[model samples]
Target: MQFKENQTIYLQIAERISDEILLGHYAIGARIPSVREYAALVEVNANTVMRSYEFLQTQGIIFNKRGIGFFVSPDAKHKIKEYRRNEFLKTELPRFFMQLYTLHIPMDEIDSMYREFINNLTSNPSNQES
Candidate 1:
């Protein structure tokens, strides 16, 4: 994953892992890759991946099992959704609204585009995958 200069790498990694969970790549109660394994996959240091895992653990998205490995929490999906929804509302929505206002774009146009986008998603199921 490409690291953004503005955000810390560990947080970005945490987000990526959250996304994987949402995508069903890691089902609830499923064991995730070890910190070292994931570090190799993303080509980052193991400490960075450990930090990401720690963040996720603090968020109750995942938990470590003694002598085993980390697994997704039962309510991880719901928690992820809640956090993302809040983040989008608090951060992304304001930026989006600003852009619309700055560009003098009408709600009607955005609604039409949104509808079209939804239609396309429904029409092409494959497009929904990463």
Candidate 2:
């Protein structure tokens, strides 16, 4: 996976894992790939993936078994949604609103566009794939 410049590698890895969970790639209570395995797949250091796993564990997104591996929390989807919503509102919304204001975009137009986007996503099966 390509790492973004704005965030640390571990955090980016954590976000990628979260996205997989959100997309149902890793279902609730399902075992996630081991750190070493995932590191190889993503071509990152194992330690980085371990750090990402630790962060997820702290956030209650995943839990570690003593001798086994990490598994998604039963309420992972809910937790991820809440976490992402908070993050979007805190970080992304301000910039988005600033752009809208600078462009003199109407809220009604934004609302209409958002609705259309959602409709298209729901109607197009191909768009649902990662």
Candidate 3:
């Protein structure tokens, strides 16, 4: 729950929740903690957690139930994956390409390194946690 200076806290919170969902920690249609409860758990302001929840709701990742707390949307997994894939392509891929260009790294070298990295990841079960 460490806050990064580069992004807003609410966005970070939303990302964390999305990650949990992807990890199967939060199943589809499962109820999540209340805003105040999650704030307490993450040691943040309730309002901040509320903002995160609102963002998730707007993204169609979660829905609120009257008299009950929020539940994960039925298609949240698909939606989250699509959103994350697009986000990585839009933000991270550009930075990665820039780094490769600045370092004068060839595409073939990058491809080889990527393959090695993937092989290592697949060989090590613990590496999949992150």
Cα lDDT of model 1 by residue, 56-117, tens digit: 99889999998798999999998888888988999999999999999999999999999999
Model 3 bad stretches (over 4 Å): 119-130
The residue-level lDDT of candidate 1 at 27 comes to: 94
Collision count for each candidate, in order: 0, 0, 0
| Tens-digit lDDT track of model 3 for 1-130 | 6889999999999999998999988888999999999999899999999999999998899999988999999999988988889899999999999999999999999899989999999999899754
Ranking by lDDT: 1, 2, 3
TM for every model, in the order presented, reads: 0.74, 0.77, 0.81
Q: List the residue pairs that clash in candidate 1.
A: none
Judge candidate 3 at residue 113 and give its lDDT: 92
Q: What is the full ranking by TM-score, best candidate first?
A: 3, 2, 1
Instruction: In model 2, state the lDDT of residue 89.
Output: 100
Q: Compared to the true structure, candidate 1 yields what TM-score?
A: 0.74
Report the number of the highest-TM-score candidate. 3
Query: Candidate 1: which stretches are off by over 4 Å?
Result: 4-6, 106-130
List candidate 2 segments past 4 Å from native: 106-130
Cα deviation of 49, candidate 2, in Å? 1.0
